[model samples]
Target: MIVVVEGISAAGKTTWCHQNAAQFLIKESYPEKRPDRQAGPGEAARIWTDWNAKRWSDAVAMERAQGVAVCDTDPLKLHFIWAMWQIGEVAESHWTAQLKFTRQALQDQRLGFADHYLFKKIDPDVAQAQKDHDAARSRPNFDLHLRLHASLVVWYETIEKVLSGRLNWELSETLPAAEHTPNPYRYDVSVFDRFIQMLPRPRR
Candidate 1:
């Protein structure tokens, strides 16, 4: 089974991943040169879609070897663009482009939903305290992450409707166990559409 741990910055995802799934963890990553704000959403979403697809592939391969593979973030990260748009930090075009590319990737089997997810929640004050005490990592977007916190819940809640029993709202004290079931929606576009349809329609 593939397990994804998703949360805002400084929410102990890395700490939990390293502690629990160290040998089979696929950590979150950023592009070497993230596109600038001036870049069109078309090109930017394609690049990001590929990055997330690669992570999904890695998780699939690792799960074959170890029974469990842990991802620091959801590989199907279209929620990012939507969440950014919800915060008014990006144009709706970005979310649309990302949704298109991400849905296509799902249809192509380049990315798929995980077998389980830990949508860990954290208080803003607790996150700030963690950021202050941890000198090693700098969360320059801590404020932005805090802003996205509520919006992210909506994102995951929408996912739970499509995925049903596969998600846990909190991280477990120990690695949660999941059995490997034949994933019918691993490459199903209808499942992708259902997930999107559950959310508010994107800008026309």
Candidate 2:
């Protein structure tokens, strides 16, 4: 099974992945080259889709070899953009462009929904304390992550509703094993459209 593990900063997701999924883990990465700073929304969307598709492909290869593969984050990360848009951090054009590009990637099978998702939900105060104590990694965006956490949870709730039984909404101390749940809508473009449509509309 392809399992995605996601959490905000200091949520212990990376630590859990390191301990349990070293063999079958696909670490998140950006494209080798950055897009132009002045690129338009469509151009940016195309670039991000390609990058995410590569990650999904890597996860598939790992799962084929090892019987399971764990990803540090969802490769089809449309939620980040939508969540940011939800809070008015970005303009709607960006979300629209990304939806167009990512849905095409799904239709092409370059990107598909994972068989399972594990989320690490933590108390904000505890997460803040953990962030303060972690000296090795400098989480400059920790505050931003805290702000985005609620919106992120809401995003995945919609996903869980749309693709039922595939998401474990909370993570425990140990990684949960995923069953071979046949995802009928894994590559369905209409499901992608529905998922996007279920998102909270961006505020004016």
Candidate 3:
């Protein structure tokens, strides 16, 4: 099973993966120098397209060997592209080429989509606090981060529709809604269990 834990920065994806003892990989762990903003838009998009395809291929290999793998973000680069565009970092003319690249990668089976997508929803205040406390790394401004997060949610919703019958997707939530206040900051273990249960069986 290949599961993706996705959300805005400071959404606790890495933390949840750690607390649950899942076989986890974080995107930042594989650091590549991204093309500078001054780079031509087409060049930057192409670079990220290739990088994301490779990342997805690597995760698929891990899942094949280990029976399970969890990624801290979606291997598809669509969300990244969307974020860059939202922040006016990418030229509009590059959109078509980038989308084409992503589609071709999927058709070629070079970039495997997640079997399940778990979207973490945290309170804005909590997320902001987490960002503020992380002094070592520079993060996007809070408003920009929020905008990116919203766009990601919409993107995943579209993915769910596109991948209907092929994949499972869910938001972090506890059962029996009346029993307790939903803690937006963390995912319940039940969410993990649900993912495991929904995994497709291997062929003989």
- Across 1-204, the per-residue lDDT of candidate 1 in tens digits comes to 888899999998999999888998999998999976447889988999999999999999998988788999999888778888888888878888888889889888999988888998899999899989999998888899999898898989988898888789888887775554645666778988888878874344
lDDT of 3 by residue, 1-204 (tens): 666777787777766666653544534343358675355766766777788777787777776776556676777756666555655656656655676666666656666556666777667888889888887757756567676775566666655564454233444442112223322212233432343234322222
For residues 47-97, could you state the per-residue lDDT of candidate 2 as single tens digits?
Answer: 999999999999989988888889998999888888778887778888888
CA shift of 90, model 1, Å? 0.7
Please report the candidate that would top lDDT against the real structure.
1
Return the top candidate by TM-score: 1
Candidate 1: lDDT over CA atoms?
Answer: 0.86
Worst 10 residues of 2 by lDDT: 171-180
| Alpha-carbon runs more than 4 Å astray in model 2 | 36-38, 173-175
Evaluated at residue 139, the lDDT of candidate 3 is: 70
**Clash pairs for candidate 3:** none
